[model samples]
Target: MLAIDFQHVTKRFPGVVALNDVSFNVRKGEFHSICGENGAGKSTLMKILSGVLTDYEGDFFVNGTKTGFTGTRDAESVGISIIHQELNLVEELSVAANIFLGRELRHSFFLNEAAMFAESQTLFDQLECEIHPRQNVSELRVGDQQLVEIAKALSLKSDILIMDEPTSALTETEVERLFRVIEMLRNEGVTILYISHKMEEVFRLSDRITILRDGQHVKTLNREETTPQEVTHLMVGREIELIRLGKGRQATEPVLEVSNLSLLWPGHARGWKLKDVSFTLRKGEVVGIAGLMGAGRTELLECIFGASEDLPEGRILLNGEVVNFRHPSEAKEAGIAMVTEDRKRLGLFQQMSVRENITICTLPDSVSTGIVHSRTEAAAAKKSIDELGVKTATAETAITSLSGGNQQKCIIARWLRTQPEVLLLDDPTRGVDVGAKAELYQVIDNLCKDGLAIIVTSSELPELITLCDRILVLCEGHLTGELAKKDFSEERIMELATKLAD
Candidate 1:
């Protein structure tokens, strides 16, 4: 029997149709994957099934009975659970508390804390995770927090699970661990509905694959019968040429140099977040940073951009001139710009228009004697939109109206407007689709040809291998190894990334 069936499912928002007459079915105990480009109906369909969008026009069946959930609680009551792409845990709560929240065991008006901790431990054990129940959710890294979310869902004992981009924030090792847990659950008769832009993950874990584009169902195919190229064609309705780095692009004169960089971490056994890290970046070359979570990848970028909480004990030189930036604005003025890792929280002004967001860093250029020049701002925004190919109705449209990939392009465009000598990008393609990622790669390549020095960090190792001229590996706050293009391999990078710090 089919574990899930959707009939004529359609969802519409204020100014857009998110899903239109989409229909598919999942056999019991099977792993089903949904693939689409950004702004496709994948998330909307999952939201409808998980009862987050109850007003959507649809008919759904769970295990053979017609059902429409009224709310998340109703969905939970019927064995439906969803782990959203953006984590849904309260940051300040303990792991145990988060797992048993709203469903706390009580003994005559007293909360059963011990029982909740025990139950949470059992769930973690099932996943073979070693997180402590008493640890604060905020204290955990993104990968660990993801595990906590999985544990919370398992505690519900849900027969059907919906995971949307679950591995988007995870390290490769953590992703492998998650795949193991998912396989175990599938063997125990749980149906999984997975959504991801990653073609490899979809191909690896899915028994059947569903494709969506522009709010409409394209097709559904068995995994064994479809290739990644075929799936990519279905997702974007076109063939995308993969981007490659220019060969023989060697580093020339150093544009930026870091010497004896070190950051002290106050609350750890290891006293430093970064220990004597040193590197040099040249004009027209892309450098990549590789590391596991908590290995100081983002922190290194933050320190370079002057956004770190604590200043490092080191020397930074730009064009052979010693410099120290007290803030990001100072760094910007010195021809250095950083596109932060967390775009939603740190990179964008969610409520502002695309034009405003793009021209925010270059406000002086758009002002004349204390008066703002709207035309100049609009023209600059339009130029960036055109250059980056940001899909939007107009420059005046809210930034949030665009998809994740376009939003990232907007962020990149914002930095490009600054015309920096050095661009620091943190996980530039974290949640982007293959088509959009290719576009971004093309942009990066063009920038490099124009002599803009770039430094990028990504969780996906293959991305670095494809885009970077050189790769630096950090392990436990230390620079363990560096690999050139000829020596690049996932196994070699992982070895360096997991090396013990001396």
Candidate 2:
């Protein structure tokens, strides 16, 4: 039986046509992958199917029966579950509590902790995960948290699963575990609609591939009959063109350097989360950090910017002198800034306005004698809004009102106001739409052209390959390998990233 069927499905948002006359189908017990560029309609289609977006024009059939979901509950009731790219678990709740949140096992009006733990353990055993159900959700790593999410879905007896960029935060070992779970689901006749940017993972796990470009259905190819290069072309809508434009001929100088750089987590495993990791970033260059999740990529950036301890076990030097920063203010004063990975948790002040968010990190520049000049702040905000193209109702509008893409732009604008010589962005484009991705790329390029040294880390390999002048791979919290622009390749980087060498 056909597990999913769509005819002439379409979804639109203000200033964007998310999906246009899209038609597709997925078979029972098949692992299907949807591929597209940054602004491609892949996510839109998933949202419509998962019932996250109920307002759409189309006919959708599940199990060969026509149906339309009014909300997420409607889809979940019918054995449909979506594992979003951003985790949705309650951080303060225990694993067992999250897995059976709404439908808790109870006896005589009392929550049955034993039953919940037993049930959750069964689900974890099935997924081959080792996390305890009693553990607090906040205590688990990002990868482990994702596994909990999967267990929650399985507990629902879901027959159809939709995973959006599920492996983006997973390490290689975690990815292997996820693939094993996927294989188990397929064997049990569960249909999966998987979306990912990693070509190798797509080919390895997907039995069929659906390509979408610019919100339109492009093609559907069988796994046995198509190659990665062909699929790449279909999703890209062009030839495999790689242009390493600013390398080989560019001058290299000690733009930024760190020695014995480290950061300490008060009560964690060791005295320090980062153990003397150090490197030099040169002008007109992009240094990539290729590490598994929890390899201290974000922590390393935090340490460099003085948000965390600047001197954990080592010293930092800008130009040619040692620098110490006890706070983020000190780092900003030294001409350094960082864009955090978990934007909602660490980067953006959620209750502020878009103008305020863009202007918050730059108050000193807009202030005169401890007095904040609204006119000066507004002028600065307007310039950033125009340059970064942040779509908003007005400069005074709330930041929480903007979409995820535009909110990212505001953060970029905020850091731009500081005018730092070295900028650090941790996964700047994760979960952003394709259109916004292209715009962010242009912004990064412009920053590099202005002679600002930028260092970035992303789970997506394509972003690193296409954007970086040089890529650095890290493994197990150690610098593994360095690849110049000419030496970049997915296979080679994977080898180096998994290998240990500084």
Please name the candidate that would achieve the greatest TM-score relative to the true structure.
1
| Per-model RMSD to reference | 2.2, 4.2
lDDT of 1 at 30: 93
Residue 108 in model 1: lDDT: 90
lDDT of 2: 0.81
Give model 1's TM-score versus the native structure.
0.93
Q: What is the alpha-carbon RMSD of candidate 2 to the true structure?
A: 4.2
Work out candidate 1's RMSD over C-alphas.
2.2
TM-score on alpha carbons, each prediction: 0.93, 0.81
Winning candidate number (lDDT): 1
Instruction: Give the Å error, residue 6, model 1.
Output: 1.8
Error of 2 at 399 (Å): 6.8
Residues 219-309, model 2: lDDT tens digits: 9999989998898888776675444445433536887787766566677655556666778898767787777666677777777777764
Query: Which pairs of residues clash in candidate 2, taking residues 3 or more apart in a chain or in different chains?
Result: 38-434, 39-434, 39-435, 260-314, 290-474, 354-399
Across residues 387-433, which tens digit of lDDT does each residue of candidate 1 receive?
98887778988887777778889999999999999999999987788
